[model samples]
Target: MGDVIPAPEAPRIPIIDNDEAAARRFPVRRIYCVGRNFADHAREMGAAAPAGKADRGLPTFFLKPADTIVVDGQVPYPPGTTELHHEVELVVALGADAPPGELAPERAGALVYGYALGLDLTRRDLQAAAKAKGLPWDTGKSFDFAAPVGALVPAAALGDLAGRSIALAVNGEIRQHASLDDLIWSVPEILHELSKLYALRAGDLVFMGTPAGVGPLRPGDSFQATLDGLPPLSGRILPALA
Candidate 1:
């Protein structure tokens, strides 16, 4: 054998534990996000989709690289915008192997290994400018420390989340509130649609979507994300580095 090539140094994503054990580290393949999957949220953003029912075709999605994910609220406030918004969402962590194609709803649940509450932090002003200019949302939505994820609860333990409540609070004040019942697409439905878009494999993460009441965040502000049947995720936003 010739000289073995040295591997390049790269960061891996840290995932919270469902049980009372140490967190697990996984090689994040992709960070897939569903846009405006909640009716109230869509309406707030002037989207045409309604909240209670599924819209025609697949839901809108965006991507973030695996390098941006951090466990819980360990990230500091990201720079580049005066308007940073907090969007709490239900995050799904896939564990089993899934082929590239349409995935059946019945078997979709089996592919999920765990669930967690995640914050889809965004630079709203940048996003708006990008939208107006017809540019990609990568800079607005995908950035360093953009995703603050909580502990992962094994899917078998979380079970069906039909009635679970998902909410976000700032400085101990409730800002966003909604239930999984209001989701336009359920977990399985999301997975089914996602399978058609990409060849999903083990360790891929999906941020389901957020409810209404999304708003801006400032330095010294503390935010908390909660999902019924899962551990709460809390973090503080520090001023941008001078």
Candidate 2:
């Protein structure tokens, strides 16, 4: 008889709410983020913004571990960086898988479960250094407790995102603001583009992208991210644990 291998401890799967009532649970699977989806933000980052649909390029995708999600509003200041930046973004949650192969943008909207506010915390100094050396941004963007998301509202309940606004405030001052209409790549387009590279599945989260006002956070700073008609995501930066 073959002996069974002893398994280690079960990993924690972070759960997010699917509705304002918090009755349903949505376990996070993978976190996929789009880089520079906002034209203004692209320009601010020193990359040229696409002039029109013809010139618009593909969305840049990156990932962070599912465990990095922080729902409790407590963000410990990550170590190894003097500059921690806050990028407020709209978070999209998938409820179902798309058909195999390239997902058509027109059909991608059906897979959406809900939307939420999210903060894409970044280690700016590390990111800048990596960019200068033409290196990957894993260390700069993917770290412990790097994503703080708010409770989600069902997509059907929220209706169209056409007139919505996303904004972030730091210590009571507005830091980033933009309209959903300003996105270079819409939600459907992002999902469609992402499907070409990876299989689209349920429980996947996509951070749509941030606006132009990316800035720093200190140990004691507090931040708030908001998307029109949805509950705001708020958290404080505490000194890193020893």
Candidate 3:
């Protein structure tokens, strides 16, 4: 018989709605994200920093490691900045591995395992500073506790959400409201494009992108996000570390 090898440790995250069980059922690999995938949001960031001439066409991309996920836990306000912002988004979790190639839109839907409400916490000040210097925003975007995800609802239950409404509220005020159809690039296109760059595997998550109207947050502030017919997911903002 061949020599025995130990199994690898599981990546930990707060799992709700049998996600842990589901995760065991379907192993996850990595996380991919598309930046400024909405026209309004693109305009907002573009207006903040004009990229050469006019800003039009093509969305930016970014990545967040899988281990950064924190679910229903205290989000420690990262050090080095006071301008921490929140960008709520609809998260797509993949179920099976897809080879890097031209993935048809239909095949794209086949990869989805479930959906979740997630927060793309950002260090706005650092992000702006990086943008001014033409640097990557990973410092602001990929920090620990930067991604907080909620329970997963199986794709079968939600069906196709291409045109569903997604909204987020702070305290009681609506901060963001838009249909998934508003996305500059559809989910399938995103998956296909991403697949070309990276092989997507089961458990991989993609935070499609956020809409306009992103702003700062502070301790004691609570927020809620909802996607169409799914139940709302809520979390409180934490103060900056001293």
lDDT of each: 0.84, 0.89, 0.78
Off by over 4 Å in 2: 1-22
Q: Which of 1 and 2 is the better model by TM-score?
A: 2
TM-score of each: 0.90, 0.92, 0.85
Tens-digit lDDT track of model 3 for 1-242: 76499756545433344445655332346778888877677787774423432453455678987777777746877887788898888888887888667777778988887888888889999999998999987888888778877777778878878679988888889998889988777778788888777777887989989998888778888888889856677888777656
Candidates 1 and 2: which is better by lDDT? Answer: 2
TM-score of candidate 1 on Cα atoms, chains taken together: 0.90
lDDT of 2 by residue, 60-101 (tens): 999988888888779999999999999999999998988989
| Cα RMSD, each candidate | 2.6, 2.8, 4.4
lDDT of 1 by residue, 1-242 (tens): 66589764343445554444665665667789999889889889987775345344568999987778777476677888888999999999888878667899998988888888888989999999999999997899999989888777787877788888999999999999998988888889889988888988888899999999999889899988888888899898876766
Could you say which candidate leads in lDDT? Answer: 2
Q: Which segments of model 3 are wrong by more than 4 Å?
A: 1-9, 12-28, 47-57
